[model samples]
Target: MVPEPSSEAPAKSFTDIQTRNGSIYTHPGLLSLPPSSGTSSSSGKRHRFSIIVPESVTDQIILKCKAIASGTSVTHVFIAALAMALSELQPPKEESYAVRYVNHSMINLRPYCRAPYNTREHAAAPYHTVSAQALGIDLVVPGPPIDGKDDGQINELSQVATQVRDYFRTVRPTSSQDEQIAVSPLMFKSLTTPPGSDPHIVSDPPFCPAVISSLGNIGSIVSASHGPFELTNVWAASEPIGAGVAIFLGTWNGRIELSGVFDTRYHDSGYIRKFLERMLDSVSGGLDVDNCTAPIRVTPNEEK
Candidate 1:
């Protein structure tokens, strides 16, 4: 959670994320996750911002964290990092919030969907399930000098990672895989349906605000070129369904990437840029906590 919102002012932070170039800490309203299926009636422009992480960093974190404990994957650490970033940054309000619980949703149904339904050909949709009620508060955000070996930053991050890992591990489906194929037409359309509609489906833990799918080593699937059209790069994003935002993660070429999509109508771009910088800072710091002894400034090699 946050230390406290200052009496002076705040840097745009969030109950939600900022715009591609916009800030999420503007209006004083619901920064709900698994945003309401219906598009926001309040209009605003949308913007996208993205950054790539070095492959070296990804590999190191994976190797080190994997050795820390069972189920301590790099994905777990990244979730901790995301929670840390969200807590530290201020949402756009007259006064920022003192974070208590992080309202986040994580959804990936591809593995659960069967056959043609799983592929994009049949419109493999993403869902947003939100609960105004906050979830558990076991996550801990690491503080300064994260690179210092004596501060226990790594241990703290590791604990947070473990908590996240355990949560998913414990909640992983106990039922057979076939039971998960409940994505009926009503359930699927309900994601984008307005509240007035009747779709009596209830999603446990609700859909997450974030939908991250690892696009492992992109070079594996993509061909070098298609006829005369050469393929140099690929960028992807799962935009916010309602007034909120969504982030995507993957590895391409030699770098890991993060892309955030938000509407400029609700967020301010300048502030969002600052927010993104802080997030990258947290990610780099957390990843390097176990490697380098001295602190270092990691720069973005590419952008989206």
Candidate 2:
């Protein structure tokens, strides 16, 4: 039987979940868009791309990261890699020298659901309860010109992954109140309002530079369908909120797929493409920290 939703609050205060000074980390480019451009009509456009991560690679990363080995899933590793890549893509201000980037990940709450509600039938139901919540995490890494040694890069990635895992374990929601806080109507209203217009929302930052969400492994569940069919690939995309970027990931049949959404008004196709490439490179342990200069654009005619 499905259980009633809990009315109890979490042990910790909801406000405590946010990272102090998180707004400072948001990419300046995203926030700098003209006020008029912040409208949904302007920022609603989205561009998407996908890449596959072999199961072996995912397993290796999990083994190497002690945090993941302890309990967390591979999603933490991807978030860390993405944070690092974005820090590289968007350099810090010359004066501050802070490579602060804030991102939120959507956590699946099906496991938290009680009894029959946790079953596939209920989860797949057209009108399931709010089975997901967005949890925020901020990444602050050293600005560029650091040593590009292979060992250094690996160590950095590992450290970031560890931080992500720790944050998820501690700061993320632990009770129904936490979930309620995450999906609050106020938060939704804040996101729709332009920054600074609403003093309340401005004081509490609603958007970040990027948002990452993972659908996890769904091959088994999908394969359980009535007919005989194979799910070869899966991808997802959503309009960026407030000129920011949205990254969606899903693992199916031992392969992980990544898709990104961005606003053309704030970013071009080439820029978005290069960013994804760098993110994939970071995850695959092929990114050269020293050579992450801006990507060169080549038109179709120029390709010849």
Candidate 3:
């Protein structure tokens, strides 16, 4: 299940995680349950991912996401829409998304899960292992995104919320002595297709479909005015698995954006772009939301 920030204690404060580097000692119990070292039979893979924000900041590019292709909440919306679209275009290995995380054994012996976006401080290791099921049917959009969408329309927020809930239902931590440990430095990729020595097929698939994290959403960071550093949004993602692509999201234009990064070995970014564009166009045009839907649009650019 996606880890929620503790309301009881203040969040860890940091000057600059990128610059400062040191390994802090965490409890031993934290590492008791070893994380799935990208080695599993079923290979969980998360398909869609997103974050919800306000429409006001939809166009503002802060530190992370730049430009407003869509509006606030659009990121989260896009993820849901994109996920649904992908489901139709390329059905995932499993219906549930495989959301990854930086397991911090020190924070609570379990793993300190990163927030969805950039936060106040950039301390502590930002890499660990944890996952949540990205499935379900009810999104509680905080702002405008919730105003006009169809009453029963299951947006990304709703879907992700459901996925989070389901994650808790399935797994439960045995202890709380876990602390900060095993920080994911820059990036992590999933083995989408099962690894093999074959000829025409992918060697590795993602252990999970989606990897959701809260690396950038530090409340203090979000509120502070760091000179020219405008805290626009945050995002997290990993490499692709099998023939499928990788997904990432952060605060873009004040809302969440669904971004994809795939391994060129399986397919080219152009193919993924074409597929996503067509998919977005299909769902956006079909969205019957009266007022809540953000200005959903797809771009025709490749990451390379």
Candidate 4:
């Protein structure tokens, strides 16, 4: 007897991703339209992401992350959340080196769009970016993700970036402003979502916090420079937890590098070394892709 033909069809290529949108819940980053109650906006626009990372990854969870990035594009974060909390939980009377600094970028939509608006539609709306650096000051209070609550405190690292986005959102007609500043309301009303792969899937890796190599990934669109912008390079101090950070970087061969900062006392270079090794081992074990220890085509600095 002949065997029955297989009933399953082949998986669709990436081109078919749009069909899956309805089945997939909204991306974690993008804010839902109508916002949440008092937080709603007249523009009907919201953010794609509020904060990064689901919550603190437990040790077991860390193991799974190691499996993915070990030998693949994924890289494991070496720092532990507990240690980061401890540094803030118990601060020293004297100043300590356990602090983190971050530089973020924002887009100046004014230059690109002659009108003020908030729709995802204007595909041609050019963007001008700005970068701002912030240092973690005294840990006046415990941060969220500690108690497992997402709140304003959790957003401190991103305050500067958010402010920049708001700046573009609220640009209004003013007498002092030139006719060039007189944006069109129709442009704003026509705002619609852009066409592309879902922002959620094209995940970028996080930055390594403790050591600031020239190539480390960091920055947000709201804070990124617009033109012949000078590169802003800043070293992040470690947190009490570990010496590592994470970033969602642009192309590896691009003009800019993004990075995140961590307090070394919380995270250390040694932890990063171990994390990187484990990551390589984990990826090799799971995927039949490659061994990352190829001849270093790029020098250590270049890898950064």
Model 3 deviation from the true structure expressed as Cα RMSD, one decimal place: 15.0
State the lDDT at 262 in candidate 3. 46
Any idea how many clashes model 1 has? 19
Candidate 4 residue-wise lDDT, 1-304, digit = tens:
1111232221221113223332232322221101011322222211110011211222233344344432212221212221232233333332233333222223244443434433345665554323112122222233334355533343121232233333333332233232212222212222333677342221123222322222233343333465888544322222212223432222132222123332332333333333333333333333333442231121111111
Could you tell me which 10 consecutive residues in candidate 3 have the lowest summed lDDT? Answer: 25-34
Q: What value does the lDDT take at residue 15 in candidate 1?
A: 16
Better of 2 and 4 by TM-score: 2
Q: What's the C-alpha lDDT at position 264 in model 4? A: 31
Clashes of each: 19, 0, 78, 58
Q: 1 or 4: which has the higher lDDT? A: 1
| TM-score-better candidate, 1 vs 4 | 1
Candidate closest to the true structure, highest TM-score = 2
Per-residue accuracy of model 3 over 109-210 as CA lDDT, tens digit each = 224344532232545534344321112322222222335553343334334423443434433344331222222211122213346744234434422232
What tens-digit string does per-residue lDDT give for candidate 1 at 1-304?
Answer: 1122332222222212223112222323322333333333455566676665556665665677687688687666666666665555423333334333343334345444445555656664443332111223332223444345323432256667777777666434333221112222222333476868644332453322333344545677677588899876776665465445556656666666666666554444444445555555665576554222113222322223
All candidates' TM-scores?
A: 0.57, 0.62, 0.38, 0.23
Write the residue-wise lDDT of candidate 2 on 1-304 in tens digits.
Answer: 2233344332132343333324433444332211222333433355565555556655454455444457556677778777777666544542223344454444445554555665666755322222122333344434334365322222366666766777676545576345543444333343465756643221123333666777777675466344676555545565566556677767776756666666555555556556666776776563222222222212111100
Q: Give the candidate order by descending TM-score.
A: 2, 1, 3, 4
Answer with 2 or 3, whichever has the higher TM-score.
Answer: 2
Candidate 2 TM-score to native: 0.62
